[model samples]
Target chain A: MRNWCLGVLAAFAMLVGTIMPAAAQLHVDVTQGNVQPLPIAIPDFVAATAGDETPAVNIAAVVRADLGRSGLFRPLSRKSFIQKITNINVPPQFSNWQVIKAQALVTGEAAMQPDGRLRVDFRLWDVYGGSQMLGLQYFTTPENWRRVAHMISDAIYKRITGEEGYFNTRIVFISESGPPTHRIKRLAVMDEDGANPVFLTNGSYLVLTPRFNPTAQMIAYMSYISGKPRVYLFDLETGHQQMLGNFPNMTFAPRFSPDGNKVIMSLEKHGNSEIYVMDLRTRAVTQLTDNPSINTSPCYSPDGKQITFESDRGGSQQIYVMNADGSNQHRISFFSGRAGTPVWSPRGDLIAFTKIEPGSFRIAVMHPDGSGERVITDGWQDEDPTWAPNGQVLMFTRSYPNGRADEIWSVDVTGRNEQRVNTPGPASDPAWSPLIQ
Target chain B: MMKFSNAIKFAAILSVVALAGCAEKPKAVPAAPPAPPAAAAPAQVKTSSIVPGSAEDLRVNVGDTIHFAFNSSALNSTAKATLQRQAAWLQKYPAVTVQVQGNCDPRGTREYNLALGARRASAAKEYLVSLGVSPARVDTISYGKERPICAESNASCYAKDRRDVTVVTSGGATS
Candidate 1:
């Protein structure tokens, strides 16, 4: 018995040593290949049941599209696929993926549940290493299967990138129609890929600046609902809305706090506009700026300890930062022409803004201390920039001279990979939501 | 260019209909008027009245609007002269309440232009008040780039858009 005990102790010690080095073998520093996209493969998901064949195909398609658009992963086309996935329940044929030169492989199976739900199980494989990197299952309604796909894509993204996933997210923007001067603006919501567009408001009133909460479940926007422009808070789950404050004047440019416990907005008092905040729980209103100059477009830092805004007090519209309590105000932007609509990045590293020059409006970013100014876009008008959840991309409203809000475009912080964010109509004031819970 | 100002007129009319007693509600675009099909009458006829609310009434008589330098809210000589005439007209009509609407060329940032438009309107209203028009009789609203008189993005068109226009809400009792 004593000899057996000693042998067990030796085995346990050896096991700890083996596991430590094995776990360290995954030297996945996703940030190292910042300039190069990782090569990935997603063979069509296997359908356990005959009726779920379409969903299995669709799930793979969406996953491929999501990964492709991220600017991080390159999804290999099926035309180049060497293996047809028939059994996702078993390990993938890694040698076949290796021949196709795929570094990573994704396999999944979809089956209809007994009560009309869809059960999807997927695994992420490190093809070159011949190992399973991630495995997860989702059970959801058939109608919401797309959301399930997004969630699955998000899980794989997080596991590989070692970062948060913004795939399962949405954006709320003002969908615009009609001529430039007679624009018909409506509040609209859609998935981040511009799918499932839903208009939340009829063309009854002009709406602007739709902002999403931290959880992406609620939004706060400005609407001229009663001929008086005021801010509104909307719930995605219930679709109910309530006016935010009893401002006797026009209130616009609403934004949510990092925690979604407060809303910061601009209130036009008499002839001057100032920044104010409203607490969601206490219904308490606090004035954040009190100056003769207009202090509009207020945004909070990711930590919520500081606020960045634009003020014209210094002769021209320049960016300013103030403490959450409205004290310690100082200017951050000092560029030619003017700058407005300052938004802090979620990573709290940079502040994106609209840089107005002679006959040009550019989307640019600067450090929080007002250093390292770099304009990412060049157009006649590119204004009101909002950051993606990952803080790598920015979406802004772009239009030419005399052009009606033409298009919504996004550019990476590195200023490459500029592309239009697809929308139903000409759109503006886009606010990206955080990853869905 | 012509259709836009008419749309503004229609927006004003709809603003009155939608808000009812709140006639002072600034003419917010798309305020229950998705299709502004009926443009105003021909410019010649509409631009002929000395009576308040008439295009010519405000234009031919009080010099309806004033323009500013690019990205500036400070009044220029042309703007001050226009406001002086507006003040004199307001003094003659004791009951007239004018809403000084500040506008800007679509050249600036939306929020900054809104603030600058407010500054332009406020600058004009202050000049009028200083010239003896009652402060209570004037209210200011900034349209920013939301309402542009010219749809083109040239120097002349943008100049036309960046002006403060005084619109009469109610004609005062004539002396």
Candidate 2:
């Protein structure tokens, strides 16, 4: 009996020694590994068992590209899959994906109904944890499958990052082409990944910043169509537009109030630019700022009780925030160089802007109180920072030195992911829209 | 040859006679050149004064010479053509130095324009170098819409502002 006890003790000691070194090595490797983009695998949805007639555009492909372009996820190619996704009973061989270093997996099944409706059920799995993270089911018209895919991507993103996903959003910008001297610009809107881009206006006259309403169906932009730089409100549904007000001076940089009832813009009258808010229904104008210096780019807080704008009032252009009724203004920018185009996030947590350092132009974000200033992107030239619906990401314009083309770029608030959004022609002034139904 | 020179002498005498007969006559002839020279002087002085060294030396600095298009980092057709002419002139002098200054229009967000302007100036310098112009003779810098000939918001102003002006520098030699 004493020999048996001694042998058991020796075996336990051997087990501890063997396990300790391996665990320690694993800990060290994890810490040293690049906390880079998480790799995910999304397989094509299996057709419903009930003889359905939904046309599959291979929507999985689109979702994969959208998430992959976000720079937050590195999607695995479908060719490397060991098992088919059509069989719902059998889960993905997570071990096979683990071999390929995929950290997460997404699988879905789609079916068509007699009423021409499509039902999709998706499961998100964290391969590393070897468990399901989220399981979502959605129903929509057969033609609306793409939107469903985007929403799913958004859901997965929000679950993993703790911030809302911007994949389901849209971007309204100015589509530009022609010569450098007299280039033509038109108001345009498209899916966040540059899909289904629809031109809201022809490239007839000069059109500046086209910002979206919170609902994402209306737009407030500065257009020279009326032969004067005035703020114009456009409805995507009716294709109807109306001038906000008849201010004698040019109105540049028009934005919608958080409630979408008023238009906030800069009125350049008698060589002075000041911030003003105009009610769309009553046309009653209220001045938010009375500074002599150039004050423009007014954005409203999510609650509509406060305003943030860019002003040269502090000698050089810097960001400042004021109460909704124009009281108790405070300067927020503390950077060494100039800051302009202060856009308040929809979430009302921070503001995005452009900062000019010696040789580089960077897209940056900062807290509402002007603290936690961080520059997310820096290169030859990146500017016109606009926020995604979630306020977790920003899309801006990036111009390279070759003079070949200008492209749109997006970066996350954490500054980890930076990517170039593909567009057909040179694009700029990207304004992100809220998710449309 | 005699007729040409005689015509010049006769024209000179007639102009003098006309000036003496009516003082406004010679005043108009000299006024044409003088008015342009004075106006050009102030405009050139303001632009060139920003450059280093004496403005009288006629050796415009890199800060005052080059320009670029809006959101562009490459020299335009006119800029390239002018630079080619400048390269040949530099080769003729052998000791002459030049500076290429880059600029951009004010339509873009600022920081990008600055880098874009720098890229334009560098591209001009590279092109000049490829054209047998000595790289050492050509220096480049970007103003990035800081200065404008026409400040009004229009395409004409933007076009003129987007340029690369070559300032021919003398190698310590006076013309």
Candidate 3:
């Protein structure tokens, strides 16, 4: 009886031991983590078949560039890549990526199909877990191989940020070059990463403040085409254009009403700038302000009923508000600094403006009631603040003191993540469009 | 576009300056003895040009100035007197239309300036309307502080830009 009891006890002990080891392996107690940009090592995609040169290498460079510009990923350089990604089934040397502080490692292999297509098979591995999170493969034409790489980057960004990737988006702005006095402005569009820059409007005429319609295919801007400053619209897909209205005076600072169905602008008639809204479909005009003050730079609220514009009627340039139908006008900005160029965010969360304080000017954001004002950027001259599609960032133009040139820059809403975007020429008046789903 | 029309526009602009050049004190011209209201009817049919010295010239020139009361859109007694003189000129032409541009001193909100400028212009328009002058012969535009008479920044200068001028828009011929 005693021997039988001991035998049962021993079996129970063995079972507990087995379960204990499994539990220890499954449980992880990490509460805090590296919140910094994820360090990633991208191995060159091994090319199975040569294309043009002696041999075509992997598309790792394209992937690396895409990830680096995301402002969220730090890709390790190839010079430090410990091992080549030659096989799909081989496990990565996780220790090597760790030595280089790469929290994530991506490996891929390229093969040429008999049908004259290139197939890229890739994998993403979590360095800390020593496990694979994703394995994806894409087939594309050799000429479009870059797209395949961008798709890979999108997948990685989505998995990490839990947000849709903006890799394939396009940005349109006024391509400005030359001195401020002789500024040659043209409409330019390019990929969000400053690639494939295409000039939409030639620099023959003066163009200022190009804003993208919600569709990203239409642009409304102020142009001196008819020898008068007026608002004009251009269709990206149709390549057709039309003037906004036949107003007698110069119409400056034109922006699309929230719905893109109307344009809100300041019309300077008889040297008095007053806000006016024009219906796109009906060619109807509604005057929002009858007062004589220089009421320019009209921006509609998200709901389109109220418009905030800059006026010097009170002696100094300040912001004012009024109804869409031009009633119940009131003062909104009691701040000391001079505020001009108020732009309402798409989300209706904040209004961005350029405040000229003392001898300096800065870009700032404030709540609708003119409270909780905060300046986001400062320089010799930084104006024309436009928000990104997601409201997560803002882009504006900054010119040096000497007024040598201007460049477009972007900064995250937190005031961090400030970076200058590359452009072929001096770019200004950057208007971010809604995400082109 | 030859010569940019600069001379014609400049001369008309000069008269506007000249009208504004008067004084901070409001002055009134003699009323044209109530022209029986029928004479003012043909005055409404004419397309008066705002040339510097035309028969319909009503605009004050660039260097000209007008004054408003403290926070008041009502033309002061002095300003009313000036409008009287202005009214006599409008009656003498009989074929002229004029625009009264009203401005305000820089001590209030811009919306108020816009409203105030309108009120000041309307006040002048009302006086002209009261002077047996047909309202149809006059128009009003308020340029809050956008077109200041004085380019400098001081109380004296601010006071100067805070006034209005009458621009002739009908029968006029000036070199």
Best candidate, DockQ: 1
Error (Å) of candidate 3 at residue A172 is: 1.7
The best-first sequence of candidates by lDDT reads 1, 2, 3
* lDDT of candidate 2 over A188-278, digit per residue (tens): 8877888777887887766767888877778888776865556788888678888777776567778888788898887754345678888
Q: In DockQ, how does model 3 score against the reference complex?
A: 0.03
Instruction: Find the 10 residues in a row with the least total lDDT in model 1 chain A.
Output: A12-21
Per residue, candidate 1 scores C-alpha lDDT tens digits across B1-175 of 3455567678878887888875565765766747877688665544312345343566666688888988778888888888887887777667778888888988877777777787788888888989999888888877777778788879999888889988877764221
Off by over 4 Å in 3: A1-35, A52-59, A88-91, A108-122, A134-154, A300-308, A313-315, A319-332, B1-175
lDDT of 3 by residue, A358-395 (tens): 65667888887888888888776677788765455678
Worst 10 contiguous positions by lDDT, candidate 3 chain A = A12-21
User: TM-score order of candidates, best first?
Assistant: 1, 2, 3
TM for candidate 1 is 0.84
Q: Point out where model 2 deviates above 4 Å.
A: A1-34, A49-57, A93-99, A128-130, A401-403, B1-104, B107-159, B162-175
In candidate 3, how many Å is residue A297 off? 2.9
Model 3's alpha-carbon lDDT is 0.68
Which of candidates 1 and 3 reaches a greater TM-score? 1
Cα lDDT tens digits, model 1, A229-346, are 6789888767788888787777777889998899998888766889999898998999989899889999999999999999989988899999999999999888878898999999
lDDT of 3 by residue, B102-170 (tens): 776433332335445666777788887789788889777665433444544346766776787777766
